[model samples]
Target: MKGIIFSEFLNLVEDTFGLEICQKMLDENQSDGVYTSVGTYDHRDLVKLIVTLSQLTGVDAEELQRVYGKSIFIRLYQSMPGLQGQAHSTFEFVKSVEEYIHIEVKKLYQNANPPKFTFVSEKKAQLIMDYHSARCMSHVCFGLLQGCADHFNEQMDIDMQPLDDDGTEVRFTLNII
Candidate 1:
C-alpha cells in the first residue's frame, strides 16, 4: 500500500467523522500516523485502520472500503489533471485502468505491486473486468466502479463474483444504464 492511500483514508474518516475520532484512530493504531503521498507502507497497516474504523463506526469493513473507494475517486480525478478534461465515458475510464493508470503508477514507483486487471469484455453496454490481486481489495474496486459512474453521471448495474471461494480472483460486470 501507499502512504497516499493511508492519508486519503484518514482524510475520509476525518471528514465523515470528526478530527477527534480520526486523531484517536491514529493514536490507537500501531502506525506512527506519519504518511507521505509518495511513501509506501505495509498493507496490513491499512487493513488495521479500516478494521478499527469499522469497529468504531459499526460499519462493516467491506462497506467502508466501498465508500472510501467511491470518494477517493473524486480525489483521483482532481489530482490527475490528464483525466479531468478527457471525454471518455465512465466505462471507458474503468477499462483503461491497467493500461493507463497502473502503467503511469509503475513508471513513478517501479516496485509498486499493482493488481492485475484484464478487460475480458468491452461492449457498447457492458464490460467485464477480471481483477486478480493478492491484496484482495475487491470491495475497494467496487467503490471505484461506483465512483466512476458517479464521476460520469452514468447509472450502472454492476455485479461482482469471486472466481474462487477465497475471493482472491474476482470478476466484475458493469452494465451501463
Candidate 2:
C-alpha cells in the first residue's frame, strides 16, 4: 500500500467513526510520529495501525471490517454512479501495516489530578445562521459553490437555493427550531 492510500483510508475511518477513534489509533501505532515525518509512512502502515489499535482498544475486528466495507461501497457509488465493475477491494489490505502505540492520557497526569470534564452549551441556530451568511458571501465571490453549500448545510442544515437559474450565486436561510 502507498502513503496516499493509507491517508485516504484513515480519512474514511475518521469521517465514519469520528476523530477520536482515528486519533487514538494514531497514538497507539507509535507511528503517530509518521504524521509529522516527511512522507515516510505509507498505506501498509495505516492498515497495520488500525488493526493493532482495534485489537488493543477492544473494538471488534468485525466492526472495523463492516465499516471499511461500507466505505468502499460508498466510494464506488460516488465515483461511478451508474457503472458497475468488479475489482479486488483493497479495503482490508490497507488495514494491516502499522505497529500499535497505546499511551494512556490519564497516566500523563498520574502525579497531578486529572481535570474534570464538563459539557458546554452548544451555539444557538440563529448564531450558526449568521456565521453561514457571512461565509456564503465569501464563497460566492471566490466561485466556490460546492464549498459554500457544504458549509451552509453543515452549520445550518438548510440547502442553498440558487439566486437564479444560472446556478452561480446561491442563498440559504437557516430555519431555527
Candidate 3:
C-alpha cells in the first residue's frame, strides 16, 4: 500500500469534481471526524469514489467510463454537469489539460528560460482523434484550436459558420492577448 497523503487524495477528488462537491461529500461522508477508508488505495475504492463523486456532481456514468477508463479524476469530473460540458469533445478535454499544464509551466519559468513547447504534431493529432473516437465517440471536433491557443499562449475565438446542407464550418481566430 502506498502511503499517499490525504491532501493528494483530496486534490484528485477536487480535480475530478469541483471543490464544492468535494467539500459536500466530505461533510456528508465524514463519520466522527474521519472519512471512511477503502482499506487499500486500489482500483476498487477508486471506482466507488468515482461513482459517489459522479452522483454528487451530476455527471453521466457512461460518459465518464468512456473517457477516463475508470480513472478517479475523470470519473469525478465526468460526474459534474459543468465539467462534463467542458469534456464535450475529446479534443477540447485534452486541450484543456494541456492548456492547464502549459500555463502552470510558463508561470513557473516566467523569469527563466521558458521552454518553448511545440504544437501537437500530426502524429499526436491523429492519436488524439483516434482516442476521441474510441473513448468519446463524439462527432463534434472540439479543442483543436484551444490546444493551439495553449501552445502559443494566445487567445482564440471560434466562430461557427453554417454551410449549405447539414454541415458547419468552424473558423478559429487568434485574438490579440
Candidate 4:
C-alpha cells in the first residue's frame, strides 16, 4: 500500500479519535507510524491499523475504511493538479479512475499495486463498475464513489454486490439521485 494512505489514515484517526488514541494505535502496531507520501509499505500495516482503530472506537472495520476513503478523496483531488479540471461530474470522475488517476499513480509509483476498475455499463445517470483487487478493499471504493458524488454536489445511490467469497471481486452500481 502507499504510505500516503497510511499517513492520511492516521491523520483521520487523530482528527476523529483524538491524538492519544491515534498514538496508542500506532504504538500497538508493528510500524512506527512514520509514513512518507512517496514511500510504500505492507498492506497488512493498514489492515492492522484499521483493526486496531475499530477495536478502540467501537466502529466496524469496513465502516472505518469507507469513512477513510471519503476523507482522503478531497486531499487527493486537491493535490492532483493535473487532473483537477478534467472531470466535472461524478460519472466523469469515476470513469477516469482506471484510465486517468491510476495511470498517474503508476507514473508516480512504479511498484504501486492499485486496484482495477472496469466499467460494465455507462449511462447518463448511472454506471456499473467491476472492481478487482487482491487486497479486496471495495468498501474504500464505495466511499470514494460517495466522495465523488459529494464533491460534485450530486446525490447518488450506490449498490455493491460481491462476486467471490474472498471479496477480490465486486460489482458496484451507482445511480444519480
Candidate 5:
C-alpha cells in the first residue's frame, strides 16, 4: 500500500474521531506512524489501523473500510483532474478502473497490487461488477462505487454478493435509481 493511503486514513481518523484517538491508534500500531506520500508499506499495517479504530470507536471494521474507501475516492478524484474530465458518469468512471486507473496507479506505485474488476453486465440503468483480489477488500470497492454515485450526483442502489466463502471474490449489482 502507498503511504498516502495511510496518511489519509490517519487524517480521516483524526477528523472523525479526535487527535487523541488517532495518536493512540498510532501508538498501538506496529508502524512508527511516519508516512510519506511516495513510500510504500505493508497493507496489513492499514488493516491493523482500521481494526484498532473500529475497536476504539465501536464501529464495524467493514463499515470503517467502506467509509475509508469513500474518503480515498474523494481524494483521488480531487487530485486527478484529468480523470474527472474523462469520466462523465459513475458507470463510466467505474468501468475505467481496471484498464485506466489501475494503470495510472501502477505508474505511480510500481509495487502496488490493485484489485481486478470484470463487468458481468452493463445495461441502460444497471451494471454488474465482479471484483477479484487477494486482499479481500470488497467493502472498499462498494464504498468506491457509492463515491462514484455521489460524484455524479446520481442515486444508486448497490447489492453485493460474495462469489466464495472468503471475500476475495465479490459480485456487485449496481442500479441507478
Candidate 6:
C-alpha cells in the first residue's frame, strides 16, 4: 500500500477518535505509525490500524473502511487541484476513477496497485461500474462514491453487487437522486 494511505488513515483516526486513541493505537500496534506520503509499506500495517480503530470505537471494520475511504477522498481532492471542477457531477467523477485518476496515479507510481474500474453502463440519472481489486477495499470505493456525492453537494443512491466470495469484484450502481 501507498504511504499516503497510511498517513491519511492515521490522520483520519486522529481526527475522528482524538489524538489519545490514535497514540494508543500506535503505541500498542505493530506499526510505528510514522508514514511518509511517498513511502510504501505492508497492507497489513494499514489493516492493523483499522482493526484497532474499529475495536476502540465499536464501529464495524467495513463501516470504518467506508468512512475512511470518504475521508481519503477529501484529502485526494484537496491534493489534486481542479479535480472537483473537472467533473460536472458525481457520476462523471466515479466513472473517471479508472480512466483518469488511476491513469494519473500510474504516471506517478507505476508500481502502485490501484483498483481497476470498468465502465458498465450509464443512464440519465444512473451509472454502473464494475470494480476489481486485490485489496478487497470495495467499501472504501463505496465511501469514495459517497464522498463524491458530498463534494458535488448531491445525493446518491448506490447499490453494491458482489461477484466473488472474496469481495474482490463488485458492481456499484450509482444514482444521482
Worst 10 residues of 2 by lDDT: 93-102
Q: In candidate 5, what are the lDDT values of residues 1-177, reduced to their tens digit?
A: 778888998898999999999988888885568899778888888889989989988999999999988878888788777786788888889988887988999997788899999989999999998999988889888888888899889999999999999889999999999
Candidates' lDDT values, in order? 0.86, 0.38, 0.39, 0.90, 0.88, 0.85
lDDT of 3 by residue, 36-116 (tens): 332223333434544666688787644444234223333334333444455444345445544554465346445322112
Better of 3 and 5 by TM-score: 5
Write down the worst ten-residue block by lDDT for model 6: 91-100
Tens digits of per-residue lDDT for model 6 on 24-79? 88877955788888887878777787888888889999999999888788788877
Tens-digit per-residue lDDT, 40-112, candidate 4? 8888889889999999999999999999998899988887888888999999888788888899889888887
Worst 10 contiguous positions by lDDT, candidate 5? 76-85
Q: Predictions ranked by TM-score, top down?
A: 4, 5, 1, 6, 2, 3
Which lDDT value does model 2 have at 22?
Answer: 74
Write the candidate numbers in order of decreasing lDDT: 4, 5, 1, 6, 3, 2
TM-score of 1: 0.94
Q: Could you tell which candidate, 5 or 6, scores higher by TM-score?
A: 5
Off by over 4 Å in 3: 1-9, 15-20, 23-40, 62-125, 128-177
**Model 2 Cα lDDT, one tens digit per residue, 16-109:** 6678877777777765533432233444465576576567567765455434534443442343332222322221111110111012223332
Per-prediction TM-score, please?
0.94, 0.33, 0.28, 0.96, 0.95, 0.93
Off by over 4 Å in 5: none
Per-candidate RMSD, Å: 1.4, 20.1, 14.0, 1.0, 1.2, 1.4
Candidates 2 and 5, the one with greater TM-score: 5
Residue 160, candidate 4: C-alpha displacement in angstroms? 1.1
